[model samples]
Target: MSNKAAVLVAGSWGTALASVLADKDMEVALWTRNVVQQEEINTKHRNERFLPGVDLSPRLAATTDLEAAVRGAKAVVMVTPSSAAREVARALKPFWHEDMLVVHATKGFEIESMKRISTVIAEELGCDEGRIVVLSGPSHAEEVVNRCPTTVVVASQIAAQAELAQDLFMNPYFRVYTNRDMVGVELAGALKNIIALGAGMSDGLGYGDNAKAALLTRGLAEITRVGVEMGANPLTFAGLAGIGDLVVTATSRHSRNWRAGFMLGEGKPLETVLSQMGMVVEGIRTTKAAHAISEKYQVQMPIAAQLYHVLFEGLDPRTAVEALMGRDRKTEMEVMSLETWEQWHT
Candidate 1:
């Protein structure tokens, strides 16, 4: 297993990263729990379920064993979805070697504890602050797999860790930037999806770009407020993981959160939407968690609050919009951070 790095997981994003690394001629092994996916990557060179129609490099080997994935590896990337990050990290703790530069490619906070993915990796994997790096931004799996131009952020307490990840993941099309605000990067990544869900709901209701634009702008305001209160640097939210991710996820058709919101706006039941979309809708669960975090910090998040009621309390989306519209008049800046928009009219 002597290699530049071994990826401890393989999903669309993971496979895309593997492809990028393999392009660099970096020896990388990808690990997956799905035997079928491993066979597909090894035999056919494509992952049909997660990354269809993309041919992966033969240099990128796939495996199912965790120990084999990490043995003699200089670095490791964990790209599983957020819900599975904790269990996977916990399982990998015994095999992880000291000095392994562990890069976390997953986003979203833990639902139960509202902890960010990097925190979960540090806690569950027994890694110190220097060992964990989070890579994020407006990267969609579809675009990345296609080798479309993309940019992302690498955040870690240690500059060396960030620089290591930046050196590995940066490419002509896929650029990587470094940041020290892990809290802001992780929070921005998770909270933007919540707002993207609401944006999709607005589209499902046939609301025009005006409404969707309003949601995106206002949603970012609340995200920044919560980030500031939670000890995240406010400027980080103004950058890639914050406003950058919000724009893409909220607008892109590839976004699962937006699709879920679209279904909700079209009057589909939550269970129906969930069943149709086999993948986990991270934002639907994150809405509840965001609402709780907002209350804990005394930060006002009206969009998240309404979304929480809509998704959980069975409130109608239209009525939710009306409630938001009919709330008592306040200065526009009080409710949102939009400086260029017209004041809400009665």
Candidate 2:
């Protein structure tokens, strides 16, 4: 297998991961259409627009050529925003090979299709869905590029593929774990952004830690509720991909979702917030898809529904909060997994 790796769409996360692979002394080719970004990365060893002030690795290269990017590479990491996942994968289709280890660090569903990132990639590449790997957890691109101590999970239905991804990306500054709960990992990764938005809005609204904590706690239950119904292992939500990701993205200054939510809480319009964010707030789109998903699965996602109204229905954030609180009093612990509760007793 070649020691070269390819990462599509050199956004902040893609650049950070490219540096990680290059730090492992593996040649990395980062693909992007932005001519200036490509040249900056190649000449100055900097991707200033996305990973400002962080010096990229010398072994990493950047290019606009999709074919050249994946050539002779053993692994390809798709890190484009969710909106572009299909288009980028489609472009790579003719170049994709069975031996290439396809991994996606992109989080969020294809809203129209409501499909997971791995599924979208597999469908576009005409490959076995089970073979693709999902890389997720709380690692932010800014912290990761600075080589902050970071950990993440790579999940696949095939244990061997998960292990292979773990080996390719892990290093002293970064740690990787493997799980077979691909569905749980992917769902957890995408859904947490909505909760993060809520958390950030709580802070922006001048609510204290108590409000934030309640939001995080209930938000997680809401995520797990939807996840288990979609065939994920409930335990996966308790691990790095679940509660771990939720906490970081909700609280961190680096989260685009949190920032967008904060702006919304400050009374900015959704369009204005998105324009100011200058990045894809995955949670916004994920919220839309999840609204449909909750309907499709006949699941009650109260928090998600409220978020949908605030984000799209133009309901005031405060009103949405009131709606959530004013709902008929209910039990705190609803059965999370739709599966047999008797399993717990067994």
Cα lDDT of model 1 by residue, 143-230, tens digit: 8877899999999989988998999888888999999998889899889999999999999999999999999988888898788777
Query: What local distance difference test score does each model get?
Result: 0.87, 0.92
How many clashing residue pairs, candidate 2? 0
Residue 108 alpha-carbon offset, candidate 1, angstroms? 1.0
- Taking the tens digit of each residue's C-alpha lDDT, what string does model 2 give over 1-346? 5999999979999999998999999999999998998999999999888888988888999999999999999999999899999999999899988899999998899999999999999999998888899999989999999999999999999999999999999999999999999999999999999999998888888888998999999988899888888888788899999999999999988999899999988999999998888888999999999999999998889888999999999999999999988999878888464353444346
Q: Which ten residues in a row have the lowest lDDT in candidate 2?
A: 337-346
Candidate achieving the largest TM-score: 2
Off by over 4 Å in 2: 337-346
The pairs that clash in candidate 2 are none
List where candidate 1 sits over 4 angstroms from the true fold. Answer: 335-346
Q: In candidate 1, where is summed lDDT lowest over 10 consecutive residues?
A: 337-346
What TM-score, to 2 decimals, does candidate 2 have? 0.98
TM-score list, all predictions: 0.94, 0.98
